[model samples]
Target: MTPSRPATAPGVREPAGTVTGPVGRLSPTDRFLPLWIVAAMVLGLLLGRAVPGLDEVLSAIEVGGISVPIALGLLIMMYPVLAKVRYDRLGTVAGDRRLLVSSLVLNWLIGPAVMFALAWLLLPDLPEYRTGLIIVGLARCIAMVIIWNDLARGDREAAAVLVALNSLFQVVAFGLLGWFYLEVLPGLLGLERAGADFSTGRIVLNVLVFLGVPLLAGYLTRRTGEKARGRDWYETRFLPRVGPLALYGLLFTIVLLFALQGGKITSQPADVARIAVPLLAYFALMWAGSYALGRAVGLPYDRTATLAFTAAGNNFELAIAVAIGTFGVTSGQALAGVVGPLIEVPVLVALVYVSLWLRRRMTTEGSGRGG
Candidate 1:
């Protein structure tokens, strides 16, 4: 049976032989515009430059004195992340000893150690910017992983499991890693004395709003929608219905963030430039690590991409929250965290293409050997 197509923008058609399934696949536009994440970021820069007073306006416009802008942005970015999972995926993943062990080792054990080293080595001159990289790095494997993994046509089940595991790990590990790397080590390195409030309250609220609330909302929406109108119906009917809403929400958030950072980009061009090497290195190194481990363990190409992408991506959502609270909005540390999406979007898009190439090469070599 031919799958129903979502109405295309003018002059677009389904690719020849394209067949979407019950689990709706990504569209070509979704696949291509990851690079536009960078564009959205630049647009944000322009907003910040042109408005100059946008931040104050955002801050002043608050609900119960809490910043509405930050709150809305967090919700928009996080909801689709949680919505992607089925709880059964989590259970199945737990039983798969290999996936669990690999994820724990990559996310909890190795990722932070290397990130710390790279940040310091690369940005010795600027202590604050260096600390920001560590903050972003340590809070690894968040929403961006899901985006990248989905784009690479990863094993979504494995990706879901990995994301849940990493989110849990981040709560415990983020604080400890922040203290050790940001506070203690930085002191030892002669940067300033590092400090963290470790406001459990704030962290809990962030988890709730960013991770927990959206997760529950996504799950409930899925479950309720499915019950009301069977899985296939919901997949074919509703998800496609709301997909654009989620996509546009994300795009809008990116534009706002970039605009807020607009004025800073020119003045802080060096900041982005300085950390580019380590950020680039981190991406390359993590991709290699995940791929090598995936191959060594004999995972299939799709699963390997999932593993590699999950391990390589950073969870900038929590990182931004922590940075904003720990360092005030204008602080360099916060700026570093803010600059993350600006850098991450473009890099990940390129990485997606690279991952596809790697999969093809590996598959070809395997076939040749078998022949």
Candidate 2:
């Protein structure tokens, strides 16, 4: 009589052979992602505008033309996530054709198409905002996919693999997608007036400053951490320690972004209401599409939840940066970028509970195994 292999951890669900654990531990204080973001945004906006010459200061912080605050925020947000990934397991995923193919198809092909349709259906008249939405969609989830995947007790290994692969695709496809949707396709739609000046040189600089540098730093840090702390210590000790710092960085970034845009939001309160519907619809639709696709592929409930969230979540940080850099902060493109987090945080929290409910139902349906 084998003592029933300890129940899968609260957040982890695997096939019959594996052990599970709590996907994530959340306290009452930890539950306020969106609220915190909103607060930071409000404060940041006020500071940026009221302080006078703050933009110059921020611009001065640039390294090789990358805004320091944004770069720091992105690095802090991303490193913990990269640290969690087991680079050793990367090869296994590369070998698994099914996981590789599915993630690629979902992230690049189907996902962008869905976003385009939703943006068009929701804001056909607001071409700039629509284009901004397209940029956000093109970016895809990078850092936060780990959080969502963990929350759903997903196949962590699979998630790690998918994230690494998606990151690659995003760097390549994002610019191309932005060009197609924001530049080329708008002309075809007879919305040439909506075009924002896009700079290939600037985009490349951002990729290097925001993306390339941080990734290298994270990789080096992870390697050093593994060597010094060992695998278990790195996972348990280091990741947990860095998590709060990452959150703080996110909060700071939100504040700065809102500070920059506070007056605009205050002046045009109604724009929030207008954009809210489409953004909400976009989230719901993307999740539904991912869930349906996972089911069709016969993935287990946890994997299904991870896939759904990963597909639905947008990399608004990168999107917002690109929008502002390319189109200026006052442009409709910038407004759309700001609107993303306003919708995303609360919506993602709600989806967390939804996934939990779905998990229970799936377990029951499958007679204690995930369906």
Candidate 3:
């Protein structure tokens, strides 16, 4: 079972240590992911430019039109996030109707609408990439929000429930939402429809492959490991070992992506920055909107932080998987999804600090009122 707080064992306090490198030094990857991602991007671009045949070789290593390297990377990226979810705690949120309803509204309704509007407003000339941005907007986060919530001192139980709910909800709602937002809505709005295969079957297949496999793997890993090795060992030892695989896979995927799309990326260097504009705007807007909404609704600081992070984050893994499955691995659409994480990690980390600062301010204000 998942602990109500940061996973700690009785008589064994959780370490307050920063992530250290192999040489016992502070690792840049732990403290600064964007730097590492930029490095990977440069390396990938160099490799692609140096050896033009490499992209072809990787593109050819596909099973049923899906790139094998990307698929494996997606699996690695997703499983650890899923495995950490405490599915058993999902039921506890039944009593907190305000948090549940408010979060769902923020995630499903307002979030997608803002993304669609921003993508259209920002990238009218870049339809394929705009569709990719829309896809990113549609997929509510199930992974990284947990980390953000923890950093912000959010309500852990509420975060767990929301995460589990979002995971199951994504599996069901993502395909239909993708079709509607990326396909039908754009058509209605007089925008050029995405020229990718948003077929229901393809969408479902991607979900099953990307989400289903990892979710099951995560559940099994958690349950079996806990039962065999005991919960304390599983939480402290097993999880710490496995958690970094997701980040490693993410870096690997970024390198492969930049390698394949190096030419396009180089030719239209400005476009990468353009793609990030709406995404950056969306994160800032969503976090502020959700935080204010939570406070207006009388939620305490912890739950408000939970609401804010959940609303702001996106499940870029699912977005990337669908983009690759629908539009080929090297397509502009897939590149948009790739850019999602590059912008997201740094922005969210900054927001975590902001959330902590807000928490302190709120506490101070409340104390003044009492005095």
The candidate maximizing TM-score is 3
Candidate 1: tens digits of C-alpha lDDT, residues 1-40: 0113333445766677864321234355454455666677
| Per-residue lDDT of candidate 3, residues 265-356 (tens digit) | 99999999999999999999999999999999999999999999999999898888888887778888889998998899878888987888
lDDT of each: 0.68, 0.68, 0.84
Tens digit of per-residue lDDT, candidate 2, span 137-246: 78777766666666656766777767666665666677676667666776787755344456655655555555555556666777898898887787767777776766
| CA error at residue 181 for candidate 3, angstroms | 0.5
Better of 2 and 3 by lDDT: 3
Q: What is the TM-score of each candidate against the true structure?
A: 0.79, 0.83, 0.91
Worst 10 residues of 3 by lDDT: 18-27
Candidate 3's TM-score: 0.91
lDDT value for candidate 2? 0.68
After superposition, candidate 1 runs with Cα above 4 Å error: 1-35, 62-66, 142-147, 150-153, 168-173, 184-205, 244-251, 258-260
Ranking by TM-score: 3, 2, 1
